[model samples]
Target: METITTFGPLTPAAEIAAAFPSSVQGKNIIVTGVSPNSLGLATADAFACQSPANLIVTGRSYDKVEASITSLRSKYPNIQYHALIMDLASQSSVRDAAAKINQDDKIPTIDILVNNAGVMAIPALTLSEDGIETTFATNHLGHFLFTNLILPKIIKAAQRSSTPTRIINVTSFGHQFSPVRFSDINFSKRAADLPTAERPDLEKTEFFTGSSHAEDTYYGFFSYAQSKTANILFSVALNQRLWAQYGIASFAVHPGAVGTNINRHATPSEIEQALKRAAELGFDAASKTPEQGANSSVLAAVDPGLSLVDVAADEVTGVYIADCRVDDANVARFATNGHLAEKLWSLSEGLVQQKFE
Candidate 1:
């Protein structure tokens, strides 16, 4: 089991970025889902500035991928940044992406793998080609498969590098919604948490395609929350496996409620109301730019100070960290019960089947 301390309410991302250390300057790092833009893109951009040996940024849209390459090149003309197109929701696309990375001659290994790409709150019961729910497929399963396929390379890099390699998963605090439903993940036999009318307004927005037909169609929010929880569980299980053997650790981060393309999936009315609420709360989503939202991720992945933690004497493995601190309450169950994490991982592994090794 892993044990970690909770560091809540981190300084704003912008404030942190101003004085942030550039630790990934010579490392080989990969940040996926950087095309559409958001905190993830900002995070990728931040890493580019560090001048890594190879910065592989990926996204689904070819045009967006091209645009990201163009933008990054203009800003950091000398950095070696490569952009690839891949659909994480599809197992085939993820496999092909990993295969291409494995075959690359430019670099022998990857020092950091930031699983920063994700979707949010779409009110539809969509399915991947493999027939799994879209949210579950992209947000959790895709990263799960991606990480394992590249584990050997990551391990090798850690062995050769000065600092240990790490995995920083970009997730949301909304994971508090519900525990992972080990018995039925697809919600095939269960009712959704939010009602149709109460769900985010998808009718007025043309954001990403949802998993169901309507807000109440199945409970997109509930599904989203559940998938995020699964993400935390995955982190717990992943850290448990890697910490002892590889000296590699994992972390989960919530980008602190920034307004991004995620609203593209919500109804226009919902978007308006959300923005209005943000205004009323004096909570500036703009306060933490994507670059800043990605600060903790940057710190977690490459910061040397973070390496001083006593991994051998203390059981800090597989703990959820937000805003640059440990969050055990957020993951107490998995920390205390390896069986539950193993159970969930086994169930998900079975569902993904051939997609995994």
Candidate 2:
């Protein structure tokens, strides 16, 4: 297999797609959060450039999804495009969307599943309809359930294809902001109130934990970070459970900072604060275009070079990818913890009220 040794942060998605045409051509691909000018649409466009048999793009709004599909149709007239309305914050919507995809004759299997839709830095301590923290619910739980519900399709695809079926969870380097608050995931308890041993180190600092009061302790960016951490842990657990038995490989990707609406919920000061912290950690803190952000995901989705590695021996399952290659230095230790991964899997199963082996 040829290696993508030269791929980097600035590499275009089309160039990466061109490297492994066989991995994407004639395959079924699905990307979430595909509104205009978003990373999801960019990823879909990348796959379309490779002649995928069916490209499914999903979003919370019908009109937006249709608009995305229309855009793809205009740009890639020969590729078949489908639209799905999936509000990841709602489990019912996710289930409905999954059923529709499963029953659709056109989408026999899902070759690549990109859990790309996410909300960042929600200004308030809002809860989803399911009563879970809004960011956690939408970013992690929703994709957790949706992916499991569609696993059969992915498994079927794995069985038919020689290469491993891929699941790319779009996480952010902001995962460095915090780990999963297992004891107080809803932010109902302040750091000071928690048992000294159980309190997270970051929460001890006001910079990470915004408010001193339990009721007002919800910092939007920290909550978003927790959910992003869950995305990586979920990928770990999914790969650990399915790789040996099903040939399904999962990856967590940090799609470099891109100027997109995912930041709409944050105030200018909040954005500045986040970037300041990122720079303090020695991160580049530089922004990329939507197409550049999509490159990491595109590589994780179809890069044949990844398939040649020994997942178990190399501990490749749930490996984090950045700038189109495996890069774990930026990931928090907790995000890659196997025990936390399993614990998260159980918690997710209980939350969704569905169990998967």
- Listed in order, each prediction's TM-score against the native is 0.80, 0.92
Estimate, for each residue in 1-357, the C-alpha lDDT of model 2 and write its tens digit. 234556988888878888889889999999999998899988888989889999999999899889988888888899988888999999999999999998998899999999999999888889999889999999999999999998999999999998548999999887876778887878887656666533444642345334323334777777888899999988888878888888888889999889899989888776676566667868767888899999989888887667432335323333788887777666777788788888889989999999897
Residue range 53-151, candidate 1, lDDT tens digits: 888888898888778878888888888877767788988898898888888888688888888888877777788898888888898888888888878
TM-score of 1: 0.80
Each model's total of backbone clashes: 13, 0
Q: Using lDDT, give the best candidate's number.
A: 2
lDDT of 1: 0.67
Q: How much lDDT does each candidate structure score? A: 0.67, 0.83
Model 2 regions more than 4 Å off: 1-3, 195-216, 307-318
Considering summed lDDT, which 10 consecutive residues are worst modelled in model 1? 203-212
